[model samples]
Target: MDTETVILGGGISGIAANYFLGKDKAAIIYEQRDSMGGLCDNFSIGAFKFDTGIHLSFTSFKEVREVFDMTPYYTYSPEPMNYYKGLWLKQPIQNNLFPLTPEEKVKAVKDYIYKPVQADDFENYKCWLYSKYGKYITEHFFLPYTEKYWCERAENMETSWIGNRLYLPEIDEVLYGAMSSATPNRYYAQEMRYPKEGGYKAFLKPMLSKVNINLNKRAVKLDSSHKLVEFEDGSKVYYENLISSLPLPALIKIMKDVPSAVKEASENLSATSLILISIGLNVPQDESKSIWFYIYDKDFLPARAYYPGLKSKSNIPSHQSSLQFEIYYSRSKPLSMRKEALAEHLIRVIEKLKLANRKDVLFVDIKNIPYANVIFDKKLYFNRNLVRQYLNNLGIQSIGRFGEWDYLWSDQSFMSGKKAAEKLLNM
Candidate 1:
């Protein structure tokens, strides 16, 4: 069979691209898993629905907004709060300095209000923090906490990735907003939206419906030289235009003849592993009223935790509530020892945080997701540029979070796919 475009991986991007390109192109999406949605997929136990993570829609692009409109989602307006140092500080902890002690608050205000010594060059992530938030605030809040989450030293990561993703308030804006007790609806999607029925999968389902998708099909090999996609079952599919949302590293390896340099680059690109542990409670109560908690302490096995019911009531039954804990670790970390050992360690941490007691928790649902996020750094930039240059030369376009090695949300992925398809149409 011949098609105008062959999209690999039925993730958000692949579906969005196929939809934008329209039905005239005869687009076909080949997905490895039995279903679509990629990492955005959800699973259910009886009446309960649990997503891979708590995803909230906050897009800055109009095209992205339209893609979000394709789904049936209710607006989620949670006054986001943080659980840190035994206190619940308002989300964007920088603006809510009141929670801190008088001394700590005064120090933070002074540092934020006055500009630090300008650097000759924006050093590493840690050095940038020192210059922006000063040593004390950086050490207390940003450094250790971020390190725990990313599983790499903050200095190793690049600072350019922070562009608008992490809000940095000007000194005047910080103090004025804090003292006035006002957090303007200043977010890409500050008042983000979520599905009212299913989980993250709900949003992706609509886009997939418009495209010709093949499920339970894994692309084991690719003859990019001949523009052929080979599946695990020894089936071959051909395409004129190809867009892939697969991880760039793994994608590079599937090529019929990858250059030595390209293969080396793929091997160099690393990612932090993620394990999501979902705990359901027999009793119905909002133990952690805050939508999510970000922990910097190594003592906590999971870096962050969020309540599914808080995002949407559809996630759990009326009489029951559940919380999802996100634990991040490098594949090399000791915590990746064994599932049994990791689960025990996670339970102990929950007890320490007083988020739950042993008896209240009914069962633990553990999900280990590989390449949860593409690691962004100077090396990643070089690797991606080289890989993309090679793939582009091969007439293949890589889109979405893992495909392009770009740190973007599902909405961004959708828009990227749509844009890539539009580009193909113009061509």
Candidate 2:
């Protein structure tokens, strides 16, 4: 058998690469888990199906759209809200400031009209936000909350990742959003297409069908110089090219001999871990609204909440409802007092905030996923470019979220995988 290109981590990137590379390439994908899709997988208990994270499909690429067409799914009309500073601000907050108080609206409009200049060159995500939205708005919402979410101060992060992800509002639009009662542009509200049957895993199922996959096989060691990987089971595989979606730090550590500077660079790239708590509820969410909500209050353990059931019936058990709360923390942080204790705390917040109640909630499930995001710090670019150059010299290609050490949604992961496969095939 030929030892073709080796793809590590059976997430969207790996499968998409295989799809683009075609069968003649003899691709082999090795994943540590029992399944593919990585963060996009779904978990089920009884009749309720919960996603690993909020996996939504929206991209500008025609190829991405083509891949999305592989599944029969539901594209929702955007209806997102931000629960920040005790206010239920509409999504695209720049274009829908109705939730803000008169004073906040006035301040935001004034800031938008005459945006203040920042003194320093961008160093972190927070600094970038200040340059874009000014100090007050960043302080009131993006700053502290983003710090909580990423588990790092903004100054510790790089700002290049802000492209496309941060939507900048025009001055006229900001004023209109503040004055008008109508919602902002629904498209810019972060609307997305979701699977109706097996949840996000459904989208992955078909994409992965064409690829050769081996699950529960972790690549414990890598000899990228010779194009070889050693699995945990003592098995070995050789390849002409390797595409990795594993966390950059872990990937670097696995290499046969990494330089001191490369190792140090990898160390500087920190990431946020996530605890996804799911609540099955007896009461259905208000049918009049979409369930996406962002929270900034420290009291609310969740940085965000959403009702997947509201997106599609497949998300919930028969005759019941479901919602997900996203609590962001660092891996170094201790797990909450206990799972039950944490669940109760979240439930209490929901009740106190009038988002949900004990009677409405039937069950709670918690899932912890490390490396949810790549913290962009001051030396982020220097470290990232150094690592990239080193990897390139070794003829190793890192793709996708963790592999690239960048923040990217599933679409970007797919795009990265496709590009990497093309590069490998051409080589």
Candidate 3:
């Protein structure tokens, strides 16, 4: 079959690309799963529901907000917390330092005030954290937590991807926040919105009607010169234009007739795989005000977890709740794929922190996502540029976080898709 355009991956980017391309373009989305939404997809355990990993989404951009506005959503302001060895502080521990001991606060404030950070062209994520928050906060909280989450030391990764997500408070604010938990605004996303009923998929479902989506079709091979795609079911289709949101490495591997240099560049591109541990409880959360928390202790597997019921009451059954945990694992540091073994380990952590009593547990669900976040280290520019240039020269437009090999959230990926479609249409 022949078409004017064929988009790969039903993720937000591919769908968004089709949306911007308009009906005259005759575009179709080829998705491997039996559904659309890609990373924006959601899952359910009994009556408890949750998004993939987005505890909350905050976007001030008008263009991005339009998609959410299409669906009826609930606006919420959450006070997320952070857990250290034994003390609890607010999220982005640097800004909310009041929970620390008097002695600890003195050290943090001293460096935050007088210490001159070693400024230079950034070397890695570690250096940036040290520069911005000073040595005291870096060593105690920033360094350890990031190390657990990223699967590598901060010194080994690049710092350019630190989006508006991080809250770096000024000296006066830090001083003030250190004194009281009822401190002034410090979170980057002061207010966030999500679907009143469904999880992330609710916001995504409205956009699907704007595009033609073909589900359960996987792209096994691509003939760049012929502008053809070969699906796993042995179907082949030729297209005049292509917009893809597949992971960069997987995309490069599927294309026919690639150069050695391009292949090498694809190998150099790295990403962290994700393992989600969602636990349902017969009990309610003690701190009903907290939407989620940032775990800094090395003893825990979860980098973070959110109360699904807290984000939306409909996600849980009456008098019952759930906690969704995100634990990132890579080949470099793989966690037990065995569910029972992991359950034991995770339960130990839960009881240790008193998050959920083991007796209160209902059931545990484990999901492994092959592509999570891209590791943006020092070699990012050289390697990403090489692969992207190769694809662009061959008339293939790669977009989205995984497609472009960058650290991007939902809004950024949506915009990237729009930009890619614009680029192809203009051409």
Candidate 4:
């Protein structure tokens, strides 16, 4: 098969690329999976349904909104929530210190008030957090949570990508928000929105509706010298330009040939893999009404859990509810718990944290995401750029979260595809 463009991977980035490139451009998307949507895909267990993870998206940009704003959708005020030390604390623990006892609160306040001047050149994420939020908040919440989610000490990781993800509250305003659960939403996902019907992937219908996609055909080899691609089925495809939203490591491996330096860099790149655990309950749960909450303890494998029921009513049975949990692990910190044992661990932790009871759970499902969140450590920039530059020189554009090897949200990945499409158009 031959085309003007052979788009690899069927994630939002690839779909958006095709959508923006237009039908007349002779472009087609080739996805290895039976369906498109990639990590944004949803699955079902009995009558209950859940996304790969919490696909809660909030966008204010017009272009991003244009791509994602599907109506009959529900919007929520962001509540900064975290499961901390066997209790629930509003997020940005600095601002929501009221969840702690009076003594702990006093310690937090004293630390913040007399916080030391931070050096201008902080090396790691830990130092940066301590410099900005004070010692108490960093040690109590940020440290434990960062270790749990990233599977690395905050000090070991670089501070390249925490700009918008971590919401820092003012010192004076901290006590006020802490004192009241009624404190207005302070996090950036302030106007959180989700589909009213099925799982979050339902919103992708617009982009997928008219795109020409070849599913179940894995692109195994990229013969870039001849501008050709060879799939697992022994089929060949020639393209004028190649746009890949596939994971960078996987992409590098499948290329017909790569230099020793590029191969070494690709192998050196670091990333976290996710073990997604989804639980379905027989009873209605409306009391603890929040969309997403973080799990701070290291004992519990779940770094975060969200209510799928809150996203859409159609996700569960008439009297049922569901919660989705994400346990992230990386090569630096291997997952000690076996996949078969995760659900049981989740049940015990949910009750221990008082989030829910084990008996209430009617169904349990788990999925593994090989390439989930990309870890931005000290060597990531040098290694990723090296591989990316080589591919760029050969007319292959790698885009998206895993493709570009960065921590990117849904909007950023979608924009990446649009940018790649424009780059091709300009060329």
Which candidate comes out best when scored by lDDT? 3
Candidate 1: residue 408 lDDT (0-100): 79
When 1 and 3 are scored with TM-score, the better candidate is 3
What is the C-alpha lDDT profile of model 1 across 83-109, one tens digit per residue?
676766665667666667778777888
Off by over 4 Å in 1: 110-115, 119-121, 170-188, 331-334
The per-model lDDT (C-alpha) reads 0.77, 0.79, 0.84, 0.83
lDDT of 4 by residue, 1-427 (tens): 6799989999988988888898658898999999789988898888888898888778665777776675467877777478877778777667777778888888887777767677767788888887888788888888888877877888888987887777767776777865676665667666778888867787777788868899998988888999999989888899998999988889999987799999999998988889988898878867457788887876777888888888778887887788888998899888877755887888898789776787787867888889888887788899999999999999898988988888888878888998999887877
Error in Å for residue 180 of model 2: 3.2
TM-score per candidate: 0.92, 0.92, 0.96, 0.96
Model 4: lowest-lDDT 10 consecutive positions:
177-186
Tens digits of lDDT, candidate 3, 1-427: 9989999999989988999898768899999999788888888887888788854668777877888788888888767888888777887677789889999999998877765577667778887877888889988887887767877778888877887767878787888888988876567777888888888778777778788999999999999888999999999889999889999899999999999999999988878888888889999655454788888888888898888888788888888888888888776777765888887888887888788789999998888889988877678789999999999898889989899888888888889889988887787
lDDT of 2 by residue, 87-205 (tens): 67777666678778899888877766666667656655666777788655777777777766777777666676666656787677777878886854544435578877888878777
Q: Count the clashes in each prediction.
A: 1, 5, 0, 1
Q: Is candidate 1 or candidate 3 better by lDDT?
A: 3
TM match of model 2 to true structure: 0.92
Clashing pairs in 4: 80-91
**RMSD vs true structure, all candidates:** 2.5, 2.4, 1.6, 1.5
